[model samples]
Target: MGSITERLSKKDIEFIENQKMFFVSTAPKDGKINLSPKGLDDTFKIIDENKILWLNYFGSGNETAAHLLEDNRMTIMFCAFDGEPNILRLYCKAKAIQERDDVWEEYISHFSTKRAARQVFEVTIENVNNSCGMGVPLYDFIGQRDDLTNLYNKMSKEEHITYMKKKNLVSFDGKDTKLFED
Candidate 1:
């Protein structure tokens, strides 16, 4: 157990900023928990107390968005490397914004990546936690994954839409994500 201050202090936020990737987890009222690892400059905005904004570049599934509609609870995690040992996790509720949303341009402008990010999730943080990550191994930062970058570059909007329609519309459990239909 840890105190909230011990969980997401300012220094802890700094540590999280250094991470190139983080895991996002969410679930609907009744379904499998969605845990997806995000990378690159897409996962972002360490906003003030009780607020977080993360960009979701194109992915194989829209589990996060789907789950959020059914339920808002979520978790974002960061594990340290090349620095002090700590594991930080933020527990919160989240809302998803589509590209058509009014604030889409405002939030998308924050990141430089050009994947035409599918959604931005604004989280209402409820608590923060930090703990000794004795088991987490230190690794050197290489760079962002170029394969994904090139993937979108090679895809046309029509093709991307088709792919999203086929893969991103539903969770593995056959639950509707409403990402494409939305």
Candidate 2:
């Protein structure tokens, strides 16, 4: 059976904290829909029962940020990949808070990461759904990957900004992510 609620319960928060990875989904008005798997530690924070913050790093595409600029609709999903058969989905309205933004420092303090974060997404959860994930296959737990961290550590701040300008400022569909805009 499936259940729907307006706010995250203690059990739901525990499940989210235990997960090693989660998926973020978003879509442009007339272009590609983006679904990304996030696994970096200290990049996710629960603000309250209805709001959460997600730290987004410089990636190949800025689809989520671009989509959020056009439309705030976003969904985050978590699954029990090793233990119980369960899936949780949070439907939300999200906004991208870039490093250049005034409120960046306010939310950035909630996370503890040395990586060059492209933006922080402030997501307000509108609905929560939990379902029995019986059809989902189980996978064993493994340690987190340090390749990205190692690579990031070796780059200078200027290099990081240059990479973001080339890759993180635009979406695959040619939409402006407003990553560096004022």
Candidate 3:
């Protein structure tokens, strides 16, 4: 199928992560769908069938979290490594828990850094599929990045949310992202 999910086996998780990058796509009813290429350690967490989590770093815009606020739908994809034939995708609805929320403490602890991570979005995964990513190329894991870490560290809390309001409040398609408030 062009786009679908198959349940993940325990062994599948190890292989799925071999790829260097994964894409996260989100959108609201009438705007642009944000497909972000996420690298480094800021990616997926298979907490359980009904729960997944990802650290949303401060970026040019907070469209991803905003989209989740408007609508819980989200999709994460992992392609195969070394041109192996496999493609995995997970579909779910999400809730973005902000820094002020109590849940932030437990989830963010998994990460080594505590800079401009605005929030951790929790997903209740609905489906998982491992299709053949035979066309996907292989890549090696280099390491984590310090540049992002330093940049986020440089900004104060007020500045971070202010930046978000200006850039992330609405999806490019003119749909409201509801980035700041509940």
Give per-model TM-scores.
0.89, 0.98, 0.82
lDDT of 2 by residue, 1-182 (tens): 99999999999999999999999999988899999999988999999999999998887888999998888999999999988899999999999998888899998989888468888899999999999989889999888999888888999989999999998878999999888888
Q: Cα RMSD (Å) between model 2 and the true structure?
A: 0.8
Cα lDDT tens digits for candidate 1, 45-114: 8777567788887677788888888888899888887677778888888998877778888877777874
lDDT (CA) for every model shown? 0.79, 0.91, 0.73
Backbone clash numbers for all candidates listed: 2, 0, 8
| lDDT comparing candidate 2 with the true structure | 0.91
- In model 2, pairs of residues that clash are none
lDDT of 2 at 50: 99
Which sections of candidate 2 miss by over 4 Å? none
Best by TM-score: 2
- Range of the 10 consecutive residues with the lowest summed lDDT in candidate 2: 111-120
Candidate 2 C-alpha error for residue 4, in Å: 0.8
Candidate 1 Cα deviation (angstroms), residue 78: 0.5
